[model samples]
Target chain A: MTSRGVRHDSMRARNLAVVLAAIHRSGPHTRAALAERTGLTKTTVSSLVADLLEAGAVTEGGAVRGGERGRPGVAVRLSGRRVAALGLEVNIDYLAACVVDLTRTVRLRRTVRADNRNSDPALVLTGLRDLVKETVAQAEAEGLRIAGGALAVPGTVEDGVLRNAPHLGWRDVRVADLVELPFAVDNEANLAALGELWFGCRDADFLYVSGEIGIGAGLVVAGEVFRGTFGLAGELGHVVVAGDGPACRCGGRGCLEVYAGQDALLGALPSVSELVDRLKAGDRQAMETCERAGRALGVALTSAVHLLDPGRIVLGGIYEPLFPWVAGPVAEVLEARLAPMRGAPPSVVVSRIGGDAAVLGAAGLVIQQVIAEPGRMLGL
Target chain B: MTSRGVRHDSMRARNLAVVLAAIHRSGPHTRAALAERTGLTKTTVSSLVADLLEAGAVTEGGAVRGGERGRPGVAVRLSGRRVAALGLEVNIDYLAACVVDLTRTVRLRRTVRADNRNSDPALVLTGLRDLVKETVAQAEAEGLRIAGGALAVPGTVEDGVLRNAPHLGWRDVRVADLVELPFAVDNEANLAALGELWFGCRDADFLYVSGEIGIGAGLVVAGEVFRGTFGLAGELGHVVVAGDGPACRCGGRGCLEVYAGQDALLGALPSVSELVDRLKAGDRQAMETCERAGRALGVALTSAVHLLDPGRIVLGGIYEPLFPWVAGPVAEVLEARLAPMRGAPPSVVVSRIGGDAAVLGAAGLVIQQVIAEPGRMLGL
Candidate 1:
């Protein structure tokens, strides 16, 4: 009898998850539409929606007009005021925090520029903590309850530990220990990819290339980041682009980072803004530098495309601003190298969210948990 | 009322699938063990097992004693004799077929050497058809029923249509139309990886490098082949290893295939066998040729490792025979190039299945379908 009761409960939970996922993905949906989408009966959908409404996870959103000459149905949506997720990101030069409601609306956002490289971990983390605390308070003031938080660090993170952030000169830092909130930590590139999936293009599979001081990529497959077996996937910066080019800090020759990383670009220009301005003014030197970087990036990305075969490639961070100058060379090299038999080349686009992608994606991590197990978040 | 009935049937099917998967993965289990593993009650497991027995999908073995002097329980296993799957392959130089029982035991295997480059699709397919027919007849003679067949071709395949086998000079050939069987067709590399998963190490994620006249790769993630958006992932041969080296047939400079492909190796020797013999005899020219190829392969593979981060890389086809000479340089470059932050390098191993991986994998595909929907296989 106990086993049967457990089985029944699990079935209910599974049904609840399905209904929640359907509404979350294609929301403003009527019960009838949800039933059709999830293959649940209308009655089952109604019962689940009622349970979610009572749990404050969902709310009715007026009437959704049916097709012409048909009766209208009441629309339902995830409740924005009931719960929120906090996102935090620590980059070499900035610390950012954001709170997003259940409907993925930004309730609070804060960013501060501080050279964190070579700084004490305690000092850097303290600044980030203050920002997160402020955001949490702001979100609560907006009548939103914080469900959880997640941190995005520019480094190799595993199980909430920031292991070896080369750019920040930090190693083996327990991120959760520094922040008082209950939070999950992941690599910034990984979160950026998730951010794109959640808020940007919502592509089922693509490579999210995050360009900062160094270039990294996040492999997203079926709407989830494809973290390799040990969470060490998508390290695109060090992919050798030229066998005999310049040496890279990673102790490799002709790495993609050496050719296209921010430091490399800056070596040829005064600043990124200046470089962009010059390019816009049709400066020959700036154009040549950007084009060379683009081609090298294309060379490395061609390898990525061949290996992963993503449907699209989203350029985030610095690349987003540099895309116009880079896209042509990147496409030319990719077309030249990728097998003609592969039909069309994968689409490459600039990230819509830009620098905020990692922080927003960090919030998405919490939202993902709530979606996976709404009962836990609802305390049911 | 009808919807409730449909839901109930689906629930039953789901439970049946769970039980079947458990047995298939870790079989020869007692009813109690199945209950513990599947989280189903002993009574529920017994009933499901009984149904499976009635459907001839499972059979009881002799009772096995439980640990620590407990009462013995009857052991159950899949009924291997009740079903079989056929596998077929069309390579650049060979056509092969294999049959395997549900227990993954090969019942019949055949391979015929025939250069298929620039060959007429109809004639090549006819030769393959004859080989498959002989294997099917042999399997039936051994008292096994052919569940289905899958064909492995070396090129881009989409929905059983060969879009372009550049090596074979074939285009837009519908494989199913060429064969009269309830069959599925896929790229040779994809099948080889699946074959490795089903019969070799069974790593949840790995890159299976298929080294033939041209190089290809199969990316497997979480026990399934990761075919990119359009099924054109894993074109590893075209990955640029040298930016200014010789031009490749794929219209790329310094592609891995240009330096490591069979043609490249054969260019320096009489035959693969003779090259191996010369290397074994410590011939300087043979050693130099093999070493150069290994380094070039290493260079290309470094790019792959940085991008995908597969848990293991299984060298298949020609690479298997040449692994001893190649593995060293591949490891050297991977270790030197991969970021130290990524922890240890992925394990590299030669495929244990050797040349028969694709054929066995083709058979495995059919078996996989049966395992996924055992009810259909059992005529339930």
Candidate 2:
């Protein structure tokens, strides 16, 4: 083929991806809306949509009757078939795998209990492979085919090596090789931020704090997770809150995690789920513990606010339910502490995705990779 | 002009600006180097440089001698003529102004002690205007022509309004109107981060925490200040370190600043500068205070590291002296807290700019704006 032909084909593919991404983000919109959103000409949008329709990547929904028009406007939506991606979220004590379709819907999911605190990379990989196999099989049964997958771990991963996974006790494990899929691995907190950016806030500057066995945060700026140079930007649990406080797993004392994370709470009380359940059931002790955690978290969030000035903060992970128990104390601490900006503090919210944030974010990584332009892929 | 002619002219102007920026950054490189750096043709660089020289915006230096010479290669450098930018730094008890040439050299400087604390917008503006005029006069005497200026303020500046300047005791002041110079204003910490990114670190991922009367941090991620959505970020001092510690100016108790900031130390011991001087003279009590401040600052830096994963933390302002005095304890705290990575903890360093960080950064903002696009009057 001629070089010009190759260039034209790449441009067409890029425009098609833009159209697909827009639809995936906004669900279904008219051709005019798609053109406007993607900044593509009508002719370009039409050509791309026609190609997608032929490839079964998108399908036409029936005409809408709302608008005043000489001709009815037809809606285009991502087809439920043809392409799908998988997400794997490996926590300290559990594993979650999900199959997501082109429309950004989870078609299949499976969760399994697994202890990854033994520092054995093999154990985590075994759990991951099993989870992926189970979820993919379920998706296959449901007639959803998976094209690729990505995993989210609560530690630093660089060049496919799991350099640190405090919760899993895994260090320097070859993540990509272990997963054995055309996949990418990212820090869990980073994914949580992306999860909220994609599905929760969509257009809000957000800080997503993933509180589990260890605590961490993800900063979403301008609708994207701000991953720092080394992929370890969200390790907030280790931020020293108490200078001479108790030593943390990361060796820092009086860190927010030492005060508010799952391990700290579990060490102080019974299992986290028990306390959370009791807190939800209005147990005074549980409520007080939640409040204390919230206060510590509030202090951290205040710092987060002072640093990034995000619009809102999204509390996610297993600790999200503690928002009600902790929000008041956190808000109180924030109001008392923050340089009052016109009498209001930044809003703090709970993650809408509940426990599915990391896995969904992992899935999003695949989608972003598949659709991103070469210029963006260069990591600039 | 015809529509096509106008469009062509706009493209030419943009390309010329690109060429100029490349030369300004890389400095005195051969035509090949400029073309390689800017992805422009050697012919384009030659043409644009000629135009710029003719316009008196640029001047060529002596010939670049040394490479296999058939026709001698000519070197180029900024003439430091045509226009000058002013930078104003507002300190708690003083104001500093500097005039920088297009070649990025400080041609003139003037500092005056002013009661900026508790000053109104008009007072601050008047002070800044007088300082600017003085500096402008100084620059003109030195044969430098003034063009525009930027002010560095220690508060959240939104639409030219100072939301709050606690040290200055100013609130909701229209800073832009007050300082009637063709200028822009931003948080001092952000500007410091920009300065460090541009001139100091250059390639280092660092956090610049301004430890003046209040505590603020500027995050440099991938060689740029990672300003959050509303441009308010890097507020490390407010991170609640002690839940029930001393009250802070921000109305919060037990903030990092309450333990580590200037006012906090002064309130605890009184005669802060005297104490610092005594410590320099090897007074044990004064050394203890500095050490305690370092510990608190270290705790805050831990949180920043967790959140940013910066390669280094550049402490600026009056905090510079504390680096050596506090480095041991801070490193101890960080080592105790950071995640067990294969490598050592991120390096913490004091900024080279010392007390002049804000003014240098303010000047840097204008330099960045002009250098980014030489043809533009200034950056917005």
Candidate 3:
């Protein structure tokens, strides 16, 4: 073993990652700032920066101004443009894609209308392939190189096969084979949760619910996405809310989706978009529909809160307009039911990324996968 | 620096403990059997066994005469009687004490009436001290030695303090200071979950619901109890089931416990013991009460299943009497409500330990704390 044993090597990698990640996260910094932020020795930080620059993972920019008279320090910054990534968000009606740089900044974005009717694996494959091509083309036109991408599918995908997508009426679609890029596929809700963790609700452990035609949820625990065994956790909308209520497409009855999902609210009204317009126009009927949906959502939130005790619930979906109407009643219902030790009722917040939470989450997945060196990112 | 780096030493200790734990769990085993069971090299197993024996953690036993002609091999087993652990189960009306061996076998058990009025820090401390003394006396009279003990309180406990005991109406009772033994304290539900994992179900990811005066739950995920931030996980009974329904002692309305807890069931009946007695006697009113409780439980279970996707649920406490009467309906309701992909409605099973599940769980807490090496119990 080199002077540093394999054990020491792992430690070194972790320490290096911490320093580099700090620089990458906080922008250019002097050695002293890095040490203060990362709690690493000056010698260790300097050594890690040298290695990162040698590997072309980081670059030194202009020297710092107004520093001590000893030496003008180089402002070390991450070489973000040196690497590229792709992020794909799959929805029931459309596919959204983004090209992100190493610094996690989106360089290019594109979208394609998707027909989710085709349960045929080949059709789904073709749709994904065409979308990737379009995304890559958009990135190239914007002068950004492509490295790898991640696909966020609105279904349970295990071992590259989409096990179920109730809204899309799709099953067993081979996600990896469909996309030619080095890609990772995960549940859209889980990705949305990661997006919330990475860019939206930092340091929050809560539930992210995507209430579209089909409802799904992502659980964030301690600032990380919590994917249970088989990656099928956080399907909150599928949980039965009414014992003898309506039937769900997934063959369950009284599911949260059957009560509060996008289709359910729309079915209660004339049209979904029309209902949104009415709510915007201060129509009482639309407001009542949203209130009923909120009550059902409150019921489901009670379950989520009881089971996991998340700190908050971030609402994401086509029905984002209903959030304002529903938030207060949902909180009231939750606080009215929760146990005393459970802190206070969790806040019900709307998605910070608006319609792009899933795409941003998908992009986060690519960054996580490509920058596999967590040890190198955090100076342990 | 200390022969092995801190991290590497932790890894080695963890690996060694894994082998030892495997042998300890499965009982006396030959070197080859331990190696096979623990997935460790035979040489590594031998070395580990030697270390354990030298450390007096294990003792040699007679060989199991095999059918083969290979030389008779000695078996190594944890010297259960050589080390002792204690468990204290503190309920609202009673205290149960248990002395367990190193191998997690309960050797002595005793109980005494307790009351919430005695929940003052000094009184609780004195009472627990007396109980531990009496239990240790019993063990000593039986020629057994004591090492350590743990207290399992029916409340939220943190840092050896009882943060909240709703049934006892006590808050922040510093328990470790009161007990005159090497002792630790945790929420009873968490202890019950550990008990189920170690002794009852043994690695099954099941929810253990205690439905006595009040309802509480413990979550076992991938064979480990999931203690949420502040150890408030598995507080399912407190999750609101019927919004705007009834006022709870916890100052919440419409909690699951308010709908299905023992007090809730008893309030619907004549008395607590009468409900159990009538259920046993097949009284129609008691049976109907149980069925209603089961339905409410099924609703909560449906929510939990959607959130956690555990493999099964182990029902305990006062709810156990309802187990035979309610299991069918609960299963039927859960099956009817759950989506198939959540993995065939998690089997609803009765706790094997029945009324003693809590006390046994308390014993499990002690065994987990005193006997097992620290590193092997990762993710606890």
Give me the candidate number with maximum TM-score.
1
Q: What value does the lDDT take at residue B174 in candidate 2?
A: 77
- Every candidate's DockQ is 0.42, 0.34, 0.28
lDDT (Cα, tens digit) per residue for candidate 3, span A1-380: 00111235665665666676677565789887787687666777788788777665678876585586887778887666555678887776687888777777777788887676655656756776787888788777766656567888878888777788766778777777655556788888888887876668764577888877778889887656766545677888876566556778766667788778777788756656778788889988778877887887887787777677676788877646667787877777676656355557777888877678788888887666544463433222
DockQ score for model 2 = 0.34
Compared with the true structure, the alpha-carbon lDDT of candidate 2 equals: 0.72
Winning model by DockQ: 1
- Error (Å) of candidate 2 at residue A337 is 2.5
- Reference interface contacts recovered per candidate: 0.49, 0.57, 0.34
lDDT of 1 by residue, B302-348 (tens): 78877777878899888888888888888887777664546567878
- lDDT: worst 10-residue window of model 1 chain B: B1-10
Instruction: Indicate the TM-score of model 1.
Output: 0.92
In model 1, what lDDT does residue B120 have? Answer: 97
For model 1, residues A189-284, the per-residue Cα lDDT tens digits are 999998998889887788999998878899887777877666877888888788877888877789899888998776757778877888899988
Which is superior by TM-score, 2 or 3?
Answer: 3
True contacts kept of 3: 0.34
Q: How accurate locally is residue B225 in candidate 3, as Cα lDDT from 0 to 100? A: 74
